[model samples]
Target: MTAPDDLLRGVEATLFAATEPLRADEISRHLGGADVRPALAALTEHYAGRGIHLVERGGRWHFQTAPDLAHLLRREKEDVRRLSRAATEALAIIAYHEPVSRAEIEAIRGVQTAKGTLDVLMEAGWVRIAGRREVPGRPTIYSTTPAFLTHFGLSSRGDLPGIGELRAAGLLDPVDEAYAVLTGSGEDAADDGDEDGAGAD
Candidate 1:
């Protein structure tokens, strides 16, 4: 029960020629009203363990070099642009509570979010302008983009890590950890021996 050879070839060619990933309907339209599911599945199976993998990320199908072979294709070292603490916090807030306005982000962060912080996230393609909120001022709102899910290897927002996972990973701030301990909500954090006079400051 394999797909037709011509259909598979068309799908493969379309994906390879695409500058970006395409949705199933887009692929179907490109192939002139053909149901491309079988072709895609067959291609996925055929490309398994090959130099390039036919993968679906964020509901868009595209071919990418196999993970193990990626380094071999790199001609030079990539410039690593590390995110600042402000940008990281803003990204997390956008991911967790999307379609949020700038005011909302600031309110949750308890600090004024600098425009540059969000500009970096947008430049990275993880955050996007969702639209203006429906209010008197109509403050601009933001949301995580499909690129965010793809980069994070998440199928959807529901796949984001939970608070318990963050706590277990020691990502929760000291303030939250202390409150958890005080309320008997979590285990005590370990002393890394650098805290002898830490509170003295």
Candidate 2:
């Protein structure tokens, strides 16, 4: 039988070489189908007080800098581009009510969503054209990508903060009020545009 030490070593090695976080099943498959849950639990405890700790995000596990000590490794300068308010609202709407058409987005926002706003999200690799809605004109629907989950540290869409949580965080506003309409109906609406004009492939 492979000892716990050996299992721990395998898990550590696999994670260190991985480009992305891995779930326990993925780690197990890489380790020849060994049950790795015990090994993972032990490793998580072992790294509890370390500068680098084993952390889980979005149902995947990886190593991350200790939150308290992270500032020690920060660079003096970093270029940060802030998202426009329209882009932010659009992203939130897509995330919460995905596979949504531009018309639906406009309806929810109560304003015309600029093509450039969606363009920026696509360029960032966070959103994608899911498919055309099964409605008149078949308007293209937009959805959040896996990159969105990874970038936002969400395990899944369900992991997004609830309305109460958003309100607690002071993030709820008049725009968010429109979200109730999304939950109430399943209508697929059309928008004026072609695939090229949509800006996302």
Span of ten consecutive residues with least summed lDDT in model 1: 192-201
Error of 1 at 87 (Å): 1.4
**How many residue pairs in model 1 have overlapping backbones?**
0
RMSD of 1: 8.6
TM-score for each predicted model, relative to the true structure: 0.75, 0.71
lDDT of 1 at 32: 89
Rate residue 1 of model 2 by lDDT: 26
lDDT of each: 0.74, 0.74
Pairs with steric clashes in candidate 2: 58-155
